[model samples]
Target: MAQFPPVPDTLNYIFCNTPADFHNAVWVLRHHPYLILDCEGHDLGRAGGCVTLVCVGTPLAEHIFLFDVISPHLSRYDIDALLNLFNDRNILKVVWDGRMDYLELWSTYGVSLENVLDLQVAEVVSRGVVRGEGEIQRMKRLQQSYISTQVSDRLGARLDGLHAVIGLQRCWKECGFPAGNGKDPAVVKMHKSIGSRMWVERPLTEQLLQYAAKDILLIGILYAQFSKQGWIPRLPSDYYYLLGQCQRYVSAHREQGKSAAVDAFKPCQIMPLDVLDHPVGPKYRCNACHRYLSLATYETVQGVAPRQASTSEVPRITTLRRPRCRLCQILALRAGFRMDQTYLVT
Candidate 1:
């Protein structure tokens, strides 16, 4: 019987920590709309979130850039000069597992990772809760190993999709994944990630950038899974609206005296469920209703306090009185606003 190799359960692609590697990544990112990003820090508790290399690019594009920390031999302002080059541009950002990045970057540099789309949330909402490497893809990978061990055990059978099995290949040119899992775990040809997610962050090494770059490039393609045309994905208006809601959510957080308010623009701070233990969660309040809401849930939504009417029609919002604005008094009463709902509206 011919023997096959083992499937890796724990495989981490190490990054290159060199200045030359970083410069190349930056050059590549100047192109492409959607990309994948990630970062690693020393976990210094409310600090230590300095970026090592910021990778950017799309699928099929080569020459990935890697912006690394200035060499010890260079001057102090060298890093600052590189940082200033990427200030405010019309670039779409994506990040996976972003919460820690939110706090760490602030403590390290005044700069926070902002304007990011959360693929982790998308994966959870679309594929259901998955922890660690416990994804259908992971199981499929196990299937390969299972067959190797049980070659005589009814062929064991191999199942693969959503995630791909690759040794060293760019996202653009690799053999894509299949679609679906479960009893319906049939093959659906894919060009990128199974669920189609995006990433945006720094890479650690020259070789690692290749993996990171491919990950983002594939994400850009998979996102189109919901679109009619492969090149143009169908994005709901609410998508952008949700981003605005996040802006308000973060701004409101800042007004509450939480230090990270301005930093709300960071990738990790964009969504609620991503906030496993939100410090601001305890302070969440509904303007229409006095009920306290967990910050984690509140961050996931926008508009006035969420209403839950058992009936068909949504109860109109009531405004509060006693120096309360009509919007709050009239709207508050009809909608049921309380002192908890009342606050200084700027």
Candidate 2:
């Protein structure tokens, strides 16, 4: 029921905590072909964590609605209507790194998001991972010449290996979005100072709420940009493939409990389908990614052991093994997961 002054940006936002506001929000949201989505909370996507605010922005950042889930202002019927909107297959939902948001929504409120396009996934897929030294150099030069210098640094570092996930803030900057308070260094510092605790605080600071709104606004802009640049897939098969990756990303941590560390290694995001499903050859199933990939996808490693089975009491000595694919190995290594290796087969 509390209303704050409009954020100093073009988008208009409403804090929808009361039942009447929620009703109007759902009605307006249903008319859009796609909605920009993001969520804010304290340690969300983990057990004991909660989603405090769900930011939904209309296309082109016209209007943003802050659905306050922390407040018990809406009835079950109102909640169900919003849930239906999320689950609707006809309507698209644009997001940036929506894994945690998806987990929190489903785990906390039983709301499963469908028909989603994650821009983070799109960004990674746009520049498919390459391994050869010549290819890496060529790609780096190409990106630097076409995109901004910062983007070259942002993306070039991972050309020889798996893709590193880009944060939404940097992603916004990389896309050449207009400068505003949202991208201000001082505001970013203030957000870091507040950290995860601010979302749980009742009557959140107007600045913090505005910060949340601006995130979805950027997401909308990124969606439009990616679409216009043909970064998003247009073909039916390619589009569905991207969508499947987005779904896989959200489901990766479904069984994981609350932990202090965010899992930086998502197989789908690290090595997208575009990178994995090519150069058709004899296939072997990877123990980690669980995909039947070509032999080139793997690296020969010696003295590597598979995860030990709990039921067996006898110790199984580590042996030369090639359990996971190359991309999975890179992901595990970057995430500080322990691995034993010999060398790349090729």
Candidate 3:
């Protein structure tokens, strides 16, 4: 793909192979100003693995640019030279779930991850896909999408559902990936005709690569989906601004003593264990949290370890009323004692 004509600020691609080529891509990338990274690599071992393929583009408008490059399956040290380029530099991308991606980059190449955005984080943060909508919905949705249906109509099976989103999502960190699952018999049949290919073995199918590229850009699409009314932008600048705003909101919300309500009443330590296995009658100790009956009741274990503080809803301490001492009560009862004055109680 080439630079999108409509949006000049939108980047096209950053293709690199050799260290020189990597440097070149960095050069080309600087001119474009904005880029989205989609990496592909081989499975060598737990640590010294993953060689990148072409880097793609997602313009804010709707065009894509692709850069084609290859890695000769070099040693980890050699790969480190190239990986350093990814270090600390702000780049836009939506890693499906980037925890392992972050770890792998650090573990293998010592790449300092800076402004990379995990789409999975965005997905969970925005809750874009919805709870328990599950893989089947994505498959069904992909089946109907322009990408999915076009592949299906052209090749007799909607390969994007099987290859890009569903198939590739399964590759979470093993070899290196975001992550996915299988579907029903009909769904199974639909995928069989599509067939899965090892991108490592050969250049990925143009369709697969396109689908993969598009899937990466889908974060931008979804971000736009939300940003129409001040939701969020898929780009790094917007995300940083949003992060700052969220931090302020959280600080103010915190100052309002929102989390201070967790200190109302504490259970006696001995009480939870006493009811141990009993499930009937006064079934108080939630087998889960081991802390009296709370919403965080752990069923099989104390699940509320790190999570105990927030879920406990510590109450804010406001005004304290003093209990009346014998003298204060006595004075109040006297014939001439004024009831209006404040008295110290022991």
Candidate 4:
């Protein structure tokens, strides 16, 4: 069996599960100007799961502090101190893909993160996107163009292919960290299988602890390299404002039902005409057939829409609005209609 490589002796791994230990960890972290933050939780994608472990690491000290949030180790004082540290604008908290982390922190401890430098956002900005194309050009299109420009050679050609933890791993390897030998494939496989269940594990194994520790440690290292390269930029105010909007949207969806939430947050785009909006009720103009037909003539097909919130109370219903009429949908299914030639009824 392949064993995971041991953590270097130069780095410190401090596990804090007691009140005193938690306080000491906070004290150590308080002095750091910048810290890389990450949280591990069960069913993290779901809104209900609370954070299990919080890892804070700094590249300068090469120290990682793991706080066991699920255990009875931390008191309210300790929690408050940790929250304060995150809220301090002077002490920047570095995170990657922080939307879920933000939601989890708010849901669990009612803490709002301040002075957050999301590396994912930084990566996007660093790559540089073309602008002023017009409203028709979507964000995805701009990102694709940006990725194409960054591709120079086969080796480091596709930064867009990297994402999440895997992206961080790639950055570390590029920064001269030991690559394949540092992590065992078997251990990585085990981590993936049991990662979502980390919160429920009564006593976390040494392997799991090491896996979690490496996450934030790599973030700190990558941030240092990115900073030195001058890839990090001062983000615009609008960026943070949009993030706040998403945070509020997620929070509201968790409270009010999904349907109610969508109704409240109407998206900014061309509104589709419902069956009732048709001059002849329950009738639609089919782009494929180029004929007005009754509602019964068309089948309701799935369309591009906002994502529904995951909740038991909500019926997981999708909004019935669609771009193409039923006859067009049926023709497409039969492989008889070409979507490129079709036109919206408008």
Report the number of the highest-lDDT candidate.
2
- TM-score winner among the candidates? 2
Off by over 4 Å in 2: 1-11, 128-161, 178-184, 262-346
- The C-alpha TM-scores of every prediction are 0.40, 0.70, 0.40, 0.56
Of candidate 3, the 10-residue stretch with the lowest lDDT total is 265-274
Q: Pairing residues by index, what is the TM-score of model 4?
A: 0.56
lDDT of each: 0.35, 0.67, 0.36, 0.54
Q: Model 3: what TM-score?
A: 0.40
* TM-score of predicted structure 2: 0.70
**Model 2 lDDT per residue over 214-326, tens place:** 88867776787787767887899988988887776555455443334454433333433224234365566666556565665565434434445776555444423357666
lDDT of 1: 0.35
Off by over 4 Å in 4: 1-11, 129-166, 170-178, 181-184, 234-346
On lDDT, the stronger of 1 and 2 is 2
Whole-model lDDT, candidate 4?
0.54
Worst 10 residues of 2 by lDDT: 1-10
lDDT of 3: 0.36
The CA lDDT at 43 in model 2 is 72
Instruction: Return the lDDT, model 2, position 310.
Output: 70
For model 1, residues 1-346, the per-residue Cα lDDT tens digits are 1121222222233233455444444445545664445443233122212444444444322333334453344343544443433333365555444444444344445554455554443433332222245555444543452222232132222121222222212212221343211011111121123321122133233334444444444444434431222122135664654344333322232212213212322222113221222235244344432323443233121234335666566644432222332212322332333423433311
Ranking by lDDT: 2, 4, 3, 1
lDDT of 3 by residue, 225-294 (tens): 4455333555777577544333222121111121111322111111122121222232233211222322
Q: Is candidate 1 or candidate 4 better by lDDT?
A: 4
